[model samples]
Target: MNKPIKAVSFAAAAVLAVTICTFLIIRQTHEDVLSKEAVIKKVEASYEGKVTKSTQSKDKKTYEMTLENPKGTYFLKADATSADILSMNRVKAMNPSVMTEKEAEHLALKRVPGTVKKRTHKNRVATYIIQKEDGKTYEVKVDMQTKTVLSADQISNKDQQKTPITKKEAKTIAERETGGTADDADLEESEGTLIFEVDVDLPDDKEATVKINAYTGKVANIVYED
Candidate 1:
């Protein structure tokens, strides 16, 4: 073949290879990207809230989603083609509610049966942080306006010492010290120490609050009141 004709043939082959490679890359990307329906489902499944708004970026490579849960409004960004949550931020903190906190606490206690740590009302939602007698913690979300328990999730497992005394042991110690009937037991961690505060009903309308070290079965103090 002549020199000019051979050069033109080589150039044409190079162009064809580039085109084929580009086409394959595009096809692979399309196959890998999540579908519209799938992206929506992924967002809903991963987040515990209603997705109020979802839209793809101008480049169509990212999805911006707004979620509203019992906590507050959240802004999230997910990969357009993959089920990966890129970023999540609380954009707006819900305004605190004034009333219905006690009502919410009642509903949460009925569900989890624990001592109330704190109650927070946000955007008509009430969240109760409760700790059980065994040192396990839980978070209960309640709809404050409607006075309903939305969710009860255990946040932590029981933190029991390797050779710690049980509730019965604590109760026995308290009753022995006070010479009264043990009525209630509350286990809590204080300054890296597990303390069991037992309520004992004394005779003649008297009461005793006993604080005992759970690990050693030793009575820390006894507070007596009428």
Candidate 2:
């Protein structure tokens, strides 16, 4: 009977030792991982914006941070242990008092009698691209808050050679490259080079702007909403 009691006690001691070792390993791992403050710092350094909110996943393996600046808002995800950026998104802000896209289009038409090709809103500014009846394309920017035209410039001449790529083709290329559909596409000229400016709607409620070269049908530059 004494031998059996001793055997039972030894088994219990082994089980307790294993449990304690497991707990210690987990605690050490947690200690080695980056802390919440450290992760926030990493995110701040990468995005240069004010952190508005921070949240951790239920599993405690990931963190989501919201950052804001004068340009727009950013949503970022980071790994809890490594503090590595998992994803980042940007969204443009819209003012309630701003004029609607249609209203801006009407105002642009009043200035130049042409068909509005595209209208985009960014940073409280509405840009309207119009193709005139004389076959010239013009870009007009309107201040949404003041309801005023900021600038209007002719981008294309009627006698200029036709572009190799169409606006629709440029939009498709922009969407494929960014993995987002374009909300607007405008043909504009920069330094004598014609390009298609496409606004893309990304996943996670974010926005992006892509510029495609009309001659090469390649992406010139892509920028997030911010």
Candidate 3:
């Protein structure tokens, strides 16, 4: 072929290859979009509250929404294309201190390697259920905020340890010491330590407050309110 004809032929071949690749890429992307749409529909159905507004950012490639009726806001990566209940709430709440799944898992292992009974997430915060060597079960709440441990408490096995005088044990001892009824009101954590806090209603028309260390199974503080 002549030089000009040869050049034309090469250009045509290049265009054909480019067109083919572009078609395949567009087709695959369309399939992915369909799959994501299905998942998003499922999320919307499962949500009890309403989504008020949805917006997409061109620069950041993020999809943000205002969830109303319940008063919430959410943000998601445009590429994620799917909404989860917890993610939606977390984004809406904009709680910068919330913990990620990985962060929570790492903290749990550090606290008690083999004693992690279960771990779950709600609204971006990680919750841990752990058991001590003494066969006591405690709920540990980690605040995603500040990446700190929030609270810890012993809800079961209050009678595991045998005290010399169980009935006469000091209120502080009962709250701090392992194997005693520490009210088990609720647990919170801070920094890296777990805190067990409880409020007890006594029969004598009085109330007691209790706190404990979840890691060492020791009581931290106790208070009586009449």
Candidate 4:
């Protein structure tokens, strides 16, 4: 009976030793990992701003840094393990004399008039979510400084119309109309009209926007930019 008891005690001691070694190894690996300050330097190199805030995730595997500069504020996420940049977004600083929400809404309505569902102002950008008569949603972003429409995108649910023209066909039409290569294309709705907004790259570093009707497969509008 004493021999059996001694054998059980030896096994327990071995298990404890293994657990201690594992913990030590993990601790050493963590200590050897890159520090947060090192990661912040990498972000600053790209953004060139004052560090406003820094935080680590609950898992301690990633870091988020907020930096501010004269141009704008930026949020950057980096992987702690490898200090790799995961994501970045810039919010242009608001100018006190910039257009108001109402003004921005009016401007956006001029471009694509519809029922305003939501309006948001942040970091000098005003966004209007508009619902057209056909129940499609459009998201329009306006730049405060220029008081011009920055981008307009449709965020409505997938169209249930199975007979609509395919995206490839839309791009071909856009390319033919603009005499340029279609660099980007997206299907969107404007004023109850389903259209494809395609960005084309033309000669001499020029750009063109081509809007093709999704249902009719016709060129709705084409505008060139220098």
Q: Better model by TM-score, 1 or 4?
A: 1
Q: Order candidates by lDDT, high to low.
A: 1, 2, 4, 3
Better of 3 and 4 by lDDT: 4
Model 4 misplacement above 4 A: 1-3, 91-226
Best-first order by TM-score: 1, 2, 4, 3
TM for every model, in the order presented, reads 0.44, 0.39, 0.31, 0.37
State the lDDT at 86 in candidate 3.
32
Write down the TM-score for model 3. 0.31
Q: Point out the worst 10-residue segment of candidate 2 by lDDT.
A: 155-164
Q: Which residue pairs come into collision in candidate 1? A: none
Q: lDDT per residue, candidate 4, 42-137, as tens digits?
A: 777766677779898876778988888767887878888787889978866744568878888899988778877667788989987776777666
Model 3's lDDT to the true fold?
Answer: 0.56
Pick out the ten consecutive residues of candidate 4 with the lowest summed lDDT.
155-164
Name the regions of candidate 2 deviating beyond 4 angstroms: 91-226
The Cα RMSD of model 2 versus the native structure comes to 23.1
- Residue range 1-226, candidate 2, lDDT tens digits: 6999999999999999999999998888777777889988877787777888988898678889888865578788889998898998886673447787778778888887787666678987888777777656778998877788888888745533356678788889988999998888888777556688999999988999998877668788999974
Q: All candidates' lDDT scores?
A: 0.81, 0.81, 0.56, 0.79
For model 1, the superposed segments whose C-alpha errors exceed 4 Å read: 96-226
Local error of candidate 4 at 126, Å?
27
The predictions' CA RMSDs to the true structure, in order, are 14.4, 23.1, 17.7, 21.7
Candidate number achieving the greatest TM-score relative to the actual structure: 1
Instruction: Tell me which residue pairs clash in candidate 4.
Output: none
